[model samples]
Target: MSYFRSVALGAAMSLAGVAGAAAQEVQERTMTLGHVVAEQFPYHTSAMFMKEKMAEETDGKWTLEVHPSGAMGGERDALDALLLGTMDFTWVHTAAMASFVPSFELFNMPFVFHSPEHIEEALSTLDFSKFYEEADAAGFKLIGIGSPAFRYPMNNIRPIETAADFEDIKMRTMGVSAHIDTYEALGSQVASTSFAELYGALQTGTVDGNENALSALNAMRFNEVQEYLTLLPTVANIAVLVMSKSTYDAMSAEEQALVDEIGKQTVEKNNSDYASMDAEALEAMKQEGLKVNEIDDLSSFVEATAPVREKYSQDLEPWVRDLMAEIQELPSAK
Candidate 1:
């Protein structure tokens, strides 16, 4: 009777241990993260790496379902969907975000970022807490920045080395007013062209030129259609990752910490990858026989477009002006 009693007691202790372990297990969640680039693009590749890390670090409690190539929708559409609780997260160009958050335009300001390193430093030291707070009020949260999207002018007309070359060139630009204002100030004929329609427009002479990050030019195979590329990366393609604020708020503290860590890790990795990818894209475009020219004196271009800065400053809200001042005070990219 004593031996049987000992056996039963041991069995009960083992079962209790198992039950406690199971009870302490982290909850499983499926995160849906989306980007506009195809799988081959570094944007998608970095996202995949981050997702893998998130799942592994959390012991498979968090698995990500990535949507690439705009399968979810355009960047703006994804932003809207996030508010409706249909999309959980997105990484999109800052230009696409400017419509929803006007202050975002500062990132895409012409000649703002001198290099990847410059922008990377700005990312760390810049005070975007206000923007984050504003995002929360509007149902979204700005988590972190992504990509080294360096924008340059690609055209069917001629190689552009100086602002003078822009005279009357029909340039395709995003619907962002700053771009239109900048190009118009430089004497280029600006027209809004959706990314999907740009290739056809350039091929058929509807627009003589367009400016985009070198990665985009290579990814979209624009070199095959365009004859010349201005090596001036006028606008850095600033991108950011965002999530639904309400959803984020609802997560457990531990889960929220994991999300924040993952976002930072992903941003750092993407910036490193973007440097190499941008170089490769430029080389590929050159091999494809696109004439590439460098602006010997960018001051000429800057001087010609000064009014654009004034125009924006005179009209923007007071807080935006203060934000721009902070950026201007940062050290230029080395």
Candidate 2:
């Protein structure tokens, strides 16, 4: 009887140990994701997707609460909060990220990425290790790269078919140096406007024009304030989904893996959805009475902006410079 009792007790202890270890593999917590875009935009849509999938995948062990439309402040403020471990996640425009991680300036250069298909290819094939390293050093862990569409000029002024059309046109741009310099180089006076304040500025005529993806233009109701959208494809509006390094560090290995998996899925969904959204939004805007024009001869605009590209790329790290060349060389399709 004593021998039987000893074996039973040993087995009970081992079973308890296994159960405790398994329990520790996933920690329960509610995380927050914040961005400065309308709920109808890709940024918010992706966040909500992430939130739902994370909850299902983790079996309620983790919850993601999303805040949209500057509830957590602008892009810079959200990034700062992430570094201080106050915010868990955010998806910011690559131009805005240049200030936080200088290497991101490589993405802000004009015509570096030819189209959405080209960007998708470059992101999958190019070496982003250097970018990831720089972001890590800046307290951000980049989990995914996504883009809606190339940016085009939108303004109440006449359609910008030629380089000369930009002359004397006041334009609003994010306060990034690369964007500001590029617009100024093209002969347009630039206003460094907060994105949240941009619609009001346009409505009040504080600026004559701005540039953004068609989906964004529609989502923000730019059609109500601006009359035309010129399809110039000046630069790719890349969006990066990042998590707080400290928050990542505090997660269990299993939990971290779960986050990574969900992050990739979220961006893949956003990118696929953007293709359709861009088309649908364009038609929606047209029906709303917004004039749209396409420029087949981007040669004039490209030539004018060539100097701006050269100026920005001149000082990039060798790896980034090499990556830029590789990306530009990739086929526009496939």
The top-ranked prediction according to lDDT is: 2
TM-score of each: 0.85, 0.85
> Which portions of model 1 miss their true places by more than 4 Å?
1-25, 192-194
10-30: candidate 1 lDDT, tens digit per residue: 422111111111213446878
Tell me the tens digit of each residue's lDDT in model 2 across 1-334: 2222232234221111111223457778899999998788778887898888776666677789999988999898999999999999999999778889988988888777655667768888878888888999888988887864687789888888988888888998756677777788788999877887999999999989998877878888988999988877677788889999999989877777777878877887676556656777777888999988876676676778888888887887888888888887788631
lDDT of each: 0.74, 0.80
Q: What is the lDDT, from 0 to 100, of the residue 85 in candidate 1?
A: 72
- Report the lDDT of model 2 for residue 26: 79
TM-score of 1: 0.85
